[model samples]
Target: MNIRPSAAIRQNYNEIADMCRKTGEPVFLTKNGEGDLVVMDIGTYNRREKMLKLREELLAVEEDRMRGSKGYSVEEVTAMMRNAIREAEGHGTAE
Candidate 1:
Protein backbone atom coordinates (compact mmCIF):
# COMPACT_ATOMS: atom_id res chain seq x y z
CA MET A 1 0.00 0.00 0.00
CA ASN A 2 1.31 3.39 -0.89
CA ILE A 3 0.57 5.76 1.98
CA ARG A 4 1.53 9.35 2.43
CA PRO A 5 0.61 12.40 4.49
CA SER A 6 -2.16 14.55 3.08
CA ALA A 7 0.28 17.43 2.80
CA ALA A 8 2.47 15.33 0.53
CA ILE A 9 -0.53 14.90 -1.76
CA ARG A 10 -1.16 18.63 -1.65
CA GLN A 11 2.47 19.30 -2.60
CA ASN A 12 2.84 16.59 -5.28
CA TYR A 13 -0.57 15.85 -6.69
CA ASN A 14 0.70 15.28 -10.23
CA GLU A 15 3.45 12.90 -9.15
CA ILE A 16 1.04 10.86 -7.02
CA ALA A 17 -1.51 10.73 -9.84
CA ASP A 18 1.21 9.48 -12.20
CA MET A 19 2.25 6.81 -9.70
CA CYS A 20 -1.36 5.55 -9.40
CA ARG A 21 -1.71 5.36 -13.19
CA LYS A 22 1.53 3.42 -13.58
CA THR A 23 0.94 1.06 -10.65
CA GLY A 24 -2.84 0.54 -10.98
CA GLU A 25 -3.22 0.95 -7.22
CA PRO A 26 -4.63 3.59 -4.89
CA VAL A 27 -2.48 5.86 -2.81
CA PHE A 28 -3.69 6.23 0.74
CA LEU A 29 -3.71 9.76 2.10
CA THR A 30 -3.63 10.28 5.86
CA LYS A 31 -4.46 13.30 7.99
CA ASN A 32 -3.69 13.61 11.65
CA GLY A 33 -2.40 10.01 11.70
CA GLU A 34 -5.59 8.60 10.26
CA GLY A 35 -6.57 7.59 6.76
CA ASP A 36 -8.34 10.43 5.00
CA LEU A 37 -8.83 9.46 1.38
CA VAL A 38 -7.74 7.28 -1.52
CA VAL A 39 -6.32 8.42 -4.83
CA MET A 40 -6.31 6.24 -7.93
CA ASP A 41 -6.47 6.50 -11.71
CA ILE A 42 -9.94 6.16 -13.20
CA GLY A 43 -9.21 2.95 -15.09
CA THR A 44 -7.81 1.27 -11.96
CA TYR A 45 -10.81 2.40 -9.98
CA ASN A 46 -13.20 0.98 -12.59
CA ARG A 47 -11.34 -2.34 -12.74
CA ARG A 48 -11.39 -2.65 -8.96
CA GLU A 49 -15.11 -1.92 -8.94
CA LYS A 50 -15.72 -4.60 -11.57
CA MET A 51 -13.65 -7.15 -9.63
CA LEU A 52 -15.49 -6.45 -6.39
CA LYS A 53 -18.88 -6.80 -8.08
CA LEU A 54 -17.86 -10.09 -9.64
CA ARG A 55 -16.72 -11.38 -6.25
CA GLU A 56 -20.04 -10.45 -4.72
CA GLU A 57 -21.94 -12.24 -7.49
CA LEU A 58 -19.85 -15.36 -7.06
CA LEU A 59 -20.44 -15.33 -3.34
CA ALA A 60 -24.17 -15.08 -3.89
CA VAL A 61 -24.07 -18.03 -6.28
CA GLU A 62 -22.09 -20.06 -3.73
CA GLU A 63 -24.63 -19.26 -1.04
CA ASP A 64 -27.46 -20.40 -3.27
CA ARG A 65 -25.63 -23.64 -4.07
CA MET A 66 -25.12 -24.28 -0.37
CA ARG A 67 -28.87 -23.91 0.12
CA GLY A 68 -29.34 -26.98 -2.16
CA SER A 69 -30.15 -25.02 -5.27
CA LYS A 70 -29.62 -26.93 -8.51
CA GLY A 71 -26.60 -25.88 -10.58
CA TYR A 72 -25.20 -26.55 -14.02
CA SER A 73 -22.22 -28.79 -14.59
CA VAL A 74 -19.01 -27.29 -16.00
CA GLU A 75 -19.62 -28.61 -19.51
CA GLU A 76 -23.23 -27.44 -19.45
CA VAL A 77 -22.16 -23.96 -18.41
CA THR A 78 -19.43 -23.88 -21.05
CA ALA A 79 -21.86 -24.92 -23.80
CA MET A 80 -24.38 -22.33 -22.69
CA MET A 81 -21.70 -19.61 -22.78
CA ARG A 82 -20.56 -20.76 -26.21
CA ASN A 83 -24.09 -20.68 -27.52
CA ALA A 84 -24.59 -17.16 -26.17
CA ILE A 85 -21.38 -16.03 -27.83
CA ARG A 86 -22.35 -17.61 -31.12
CA GLU A 87 -25.70 -15.84 -31.08
CA ALA A 88 -24.02 -12.56 -30.16
CA GLU A 89 -21.55 -12.98 -33.03
CA GLY A 90 -24.44 -13.41 -35.51
CA HIS A 91 -23.80 -17.11 -36.00
CA GLY A 92 -27.45 -17.84 -34.95
CA THR A 93 -26.78 -21.14 -33.22
CA ALA A 94 -24.19 -23.08 -31.19
CA GLU A 95 -24.90 -26.14 -33.39
Candidate 2:
Protein backbone atom coordinates (compact mmCIF):
# COMPACT_ATOMS: atom_id res chain seq x y z
CA MET A 1 0.00 0.00 0.00
CA ASN A 2 1.21 3.48 -0.84
CA ILE A 3 1.50 5.87 2.09
CA ARG A 4 0.74 9.51 1.32
CA PRO A 5 3.74 11.79 0.96
CA SER A 6 4.24 14.28 3.80
CA ALA A 7 4.77 17.97 2.99
CA ALA A 8 8.33 17.75 4.31
CA ILE A 9 9.07 14.63 2.33
CA ARG A 10 7.56 16.76 -0.37
CA GLN A 11 9.00 20.13 0.83
CA ASN A 12 11.96 20.06 3.24
CA TYR A 13 15.03 18.06 4.41
CA ASN A 14 14.35 18.11 8.18
CA GLU A 15 10.91 16.71 7.45
CA ILE A 16 12.37 13.39 6.33
CA ALA A 17 14.28 13.15 9.59
CA ASP A 18 11.22 14.11 11.66
CA MET A 19 8.82 11.84 9.79
CA CYS A 20 11.18 8.87 9.82
CA ARG A 21 11.09 9.06 13.62
CA LYS A 22 7.30 8.86 13.60
CA THR A 23 6.38 6.50 10.75
CA GLY A 24 9.38 4.16 10.73
CA GLU A 25 8.94 4.48 6.97
CA PRO A 26 11.08 6.43 4.55
CA VAL A 27 10.27 9.38 2.31
CA PHE A 28 11.59 10.47 -1.05
CA LEU A 29 14.39 12.95 -1.74
CA THR A 30 16.50 14.25 -4.62
CA LYS A 31 20.26 14.72 -4.56
CA ASN A 32 22.27 17.47 -6.26
CA GLY A 33 22.51 16.57 -9.96
CA GLU A 34 20.09 13.71 -9.21
CA GLY A 35 16.32 13.05 -9.28
CA ASP A 36 13.50 11.95 -6.93
CA LEU A 37 13.77 8.74 -4.91
CA VAL A 38 12.52 7.31 -1.62
CA VAL A 39 14.30 7.69 1.73
CA MET A 40 13.62 5.37 4.69
CA ASP A 41 15.13 3.55 7.63
CA ILE A 42 16.77 0.17 7.09
CA GLY A 43 14.41 -1.28 9.69
CA THR A 44 11.38 -0.28 7.63
CA TYR A 45 13.05 -1.63 4.50
CA ASN A 46 13.62 -5.07 6.07
CA ARG A 47 10.12 -5.25 7.54
CA ARG A 48 8.53 -4.35 4.19
CA GLU A 49 10.16 -7.36 2.55
CA LYS A 50 7.67 -10.09 1.58
CA MET A 51 7.81 -13.86 1.18
CA LEU A 52 5.56 -16.82 0.31
CA LYS A 53 5.88 -18.32 3.81
CA LEU A 54 2.16 -18.14 4.61
CA ARG A 55 1.09 -19.82 1.38
CA GLU A 56 3.72 -22.53 1.80
CA GLU A 57 2.46 -23.36 5.31
CA LEU A 58 -1.17 -23.64 4.20
CA LEU A 59 -0.30 -25.84 1.19
CA ALA A 60 1.82 -28.15 3.35
CA VAL A 61 -1.03 -28.70 5.84
CA GLU A 62 -3.52 -29.42 3.06
CA GLU A 63 -1.15 -31.90 1.41
CA ASP A 64 -0.54 -33.70 4.69
CA ARG A 65 -4.26 -34.09 5.47
CA MET A 66 -5.01 -35.33 1.95
CA ARG A 67 -2.13 -37.84 2.12
CA GLY A 68 -3.49 -39.48 5.32
CA SER A 69 -1.99 -37.48 8.13
CA LYS A 70 -2.94 -39.17 11.41
CA GLY A 71 -6.57 -38.55 12.34
CA TYR A 72 -7.85 -37.98 15.89
CA SER A 73 -10.77 -39.95 17.32
CA VAL A 74 -14.10 -38.17 18.03
CA GLU A 75 -13.69 -38.62 21.79
CA GLU A 76 -10.30 -36.93 21.72
CA VAL A 77 -11.67 -34.03 19.63
CA THR A 78 -14.72 -33.69 21.94
CA ALA A 79 -12.46 -33.51 24.98
CA MET A 80 -10.41 -30.80 23.31
CA MET A 81 -13.56 -28.80 22.54
CA ARG A 82 -14.80 -29.10 26.11
CA ASN A 83 -11.41 -27.95 27.36
CA ALA A 84 -11.44 -24.90 25.04
CA ILE A 85 -15.00 -23.92 26.07
CA ARG A 86 -14.09 -24.15 29.73
CA GLU A 87 -11.04 -21.96 29.13
CA ALA A 88 -13.11 -19.36 27.24
CA GLU A 89 -15.56 -19.23 30.20
CA GLY A 90 -12.61 -18.31 32.51
CA HIS A 91 -12.82 -21.47 34.59
CA GLY A 92 -9.65 -22.96 36.13
CA THR A 93 -10.04 -26.34 34.51
CA ALA A 94 -12.33 -28.64 32.52
CA GLU A 95 -13.68 -31.80 34.11
Candidate 3:
Protein backbone atom coordinates (compact mmCIF):
# COMPACT_ATOMS: atom_id res chain seq x y z
CA MET A 1 0.00 0.00 0.00
CA ASN A 2 3.01 2.21 -0.14
CA ILE A 3 2.73 4.54 -3.13
CA ARG A 4 5.17 7.12 -4.40
CA PRO A 5 5.74 9.20 -7.48
CA SER A 6 8.35 7.84 -9.89
CA ALA A 7 10.51 10.87 -9.29
CA ALA A 8 10.81 9.93 -5.65
CA ILE A 9 13.07 7.05 -6.68
CA ARG A 10 15.57 9.50 -8.06
CA GLN A 11 15.08 12.22 -5.44
CA ASN A 12 14.86 10.04 -2.33
CA TYR A 13 16.38 6.73 -3.24
CA ASN A 14 17.91 6.06 0.16
CA GLU A 15 14.68 6.69 2.08
CA ILE A 16 12.68 4.44 -0.21
CA ALA A 17 15.36 1.72 0.02
CA ASP A 18 15.31 1.92 3.79
CA MET A 19 11.52 1.67 3.90
CA CYS A 20 11.54 -1.43 1.67
CA ARG A 21 14.28 -3.08 3.74
CA LYS A 22 12.58 -2.31 7.04
CA THR A 23 9.03 -3.23 5.94
CA GLY A 24 9.78 -6.17 3.62
CA GLU A 25 7.18 -4.71 1.25
CA PRO A 26 7.18 -3.16 -2.16
CA VAL A 27 6.75 0.52 -2.92
CA PHE A 28 4.46 1.27 -5.85
CA LEU A 29 5.74 4.03 -8.08
CA THR A 30 3.38 6.09 -10.22
CA LYS A 31 4.30 7.98 -13.34
CA ASN A 32 1.96 10.87 -14.18
CA GLY A 33 -0.53 9.52 -11.66
CA GLU A 34 -0.53 6.08 -13.23
CA GLY A 35 1.08 2.95 -11.86
CA ASP A 36 4.62 2.71 -13.20
CA LEU A 37 6.90 0.36 -11.24
CA VAL A 38 7.51 -1.44 -7.98
CA VAL A 39 10.59 -1.38 -5.75
CA MET A 40 11.56 -3.85 -3.03
CA ASP A 41 14.60 -5.14 -1.25
CA ILE A 42 16.37 -8.13 -2.87
CA GLY A 43 15.68 -10.49 0.01
CA THR A 44 11.95 -9.68 0.03
CA TYR A 45 11.75 -10.02 -3.75
CA ASN A 46 13.46 -13.44 -3.66
CA ARG A 47 11.23 -14.65 -0.84
CA ARG A 48 8.15 -13.49 -2.71
CA GLU A 49 9.29 -15.28 -5.82
CA LYS A 50 9.91 -18.46 -3.81
CA MET A 51 6.44 -18.25 -2.30
CA LEU A 52 4.86 -17.78 -5.74
CA LYS A 53 6.73 -20.77 -7.09
CA LEU A 54 5.60 -22.86 -4.12
CA ARG A 55 2.01 -21.80 -4.71
CA GLU A 56 2.25 -22.77 -8.35
CA GLU A 57 3.62 -26.18 -7.36
CA LEU A 58 0.83 -26.68 -4.84
CA LEU A 59 -1.74 -25.72 -7.44
CA ALA A 60 -0.30 -28.25 -9.83
CA VAL A 61 -0.44 -30.93 -7.15
CA GLU A 62 -4.09 -30.06 -6.47
CA GLU A 63 -4.90 -30.29 -10.16
CA ASP A 64 -3.25 -33.69 -10.33
CA ARG A 65 -5.24 -34.85 -7.33
CA MET A 66 -8.42 -33.64 -8.99
CA ARG A 67 -7.47 -35.75 -11.99
CA GLY A 68 -7.25 -38.87 -9.76
CA SER A 69 -3.54 -38.96 -9.27
CA LYS A 70 -2.10 -41.45 -6.79
CA GLY A 71 -1.35 -40.15 -3.29
CA TYR A 72 0.31 -41.66 -0.24
CA SER A 73 -1.76 -42.43 2.82
CA VAL A 74 -1.01 -40.62 6.07
CA GLU A 75 0.70 -43.69 7.57
CA GLU A 76 2.81 -44.16 4.46
CA VAL A 77 3.79 -40.50 4.48
CA THR A 78 4.66 -40.65 8.15
CA ALA A 79 6.83 -43.71 7.67
CA MET A 80 8.57 -42.08 4.72
CA MET A 81 9.27 -38.98 6.78
CA ARG A 82 10.59 -41.10 9.62
CA ASN A 83 12.90 -42.93 7.27
CA ALA A 84 14.15 -39.67 5.82
CA ILE A 85 14.80 -38.27 9.27
CA ARG A 86 16.69 -41.37 10.29
CA GLU A 87 18.82 -41.21 7.12
CA ALA A 88 19.53 -37.51 7.63
CA GLU A 89 20.57 -38.12 11.22
CA GLY A 90 22.82 -41.05 10.16
CA HIS A 91 20.92 -43.40 12.42
CA GLY A 92 20.65 -46.13 9.78
CA THR A 93 17.11 -47.02 8.66
CA ALA A 94 13.73 -46.67 10.33
CA GLU A 95 12.12 -49.97 11.27
Question: Candidate 2 lDDT, tens digit per residue, 1-95?
Answer: 22334444646656566677678866655455344567776666666653356667778988999999986899989988999989999984587
lDDT, residue 67, model 2 = 100
lDDT (Cα, 0-100) at 9 in candidate 2: 60
Evaluate model 2: give its TM-score.
0.32
lDDT of 3 by residue, 13-79 (tens): 9999999999999999999999999999999999999999999999999999999999999999999
* Model with the higher TM-score, candidate 1 or 2: 1
- lDDT-better candidate, 2 vs 3: 3
Per-residue alpha-carbon lDDT of candidate 1 for residues 1-95, written as tens digits (9 for 90 to 100): 99999998879999999999999999999999999999999999899899999999999999999999999999999999999999999999787
Candidate 2, clashing residue pairs?
26-40, 27-39
Stretches > 4 Å off in candidate 3? 78-95
Q: Candidate 1: list runs displaced more than 4 Å.
A: 74-95
Better of 2 and 3 by TM-score: 3
Best by lDDT: 3
Report the number of the highest-TM-score candidate.
Answer: 3
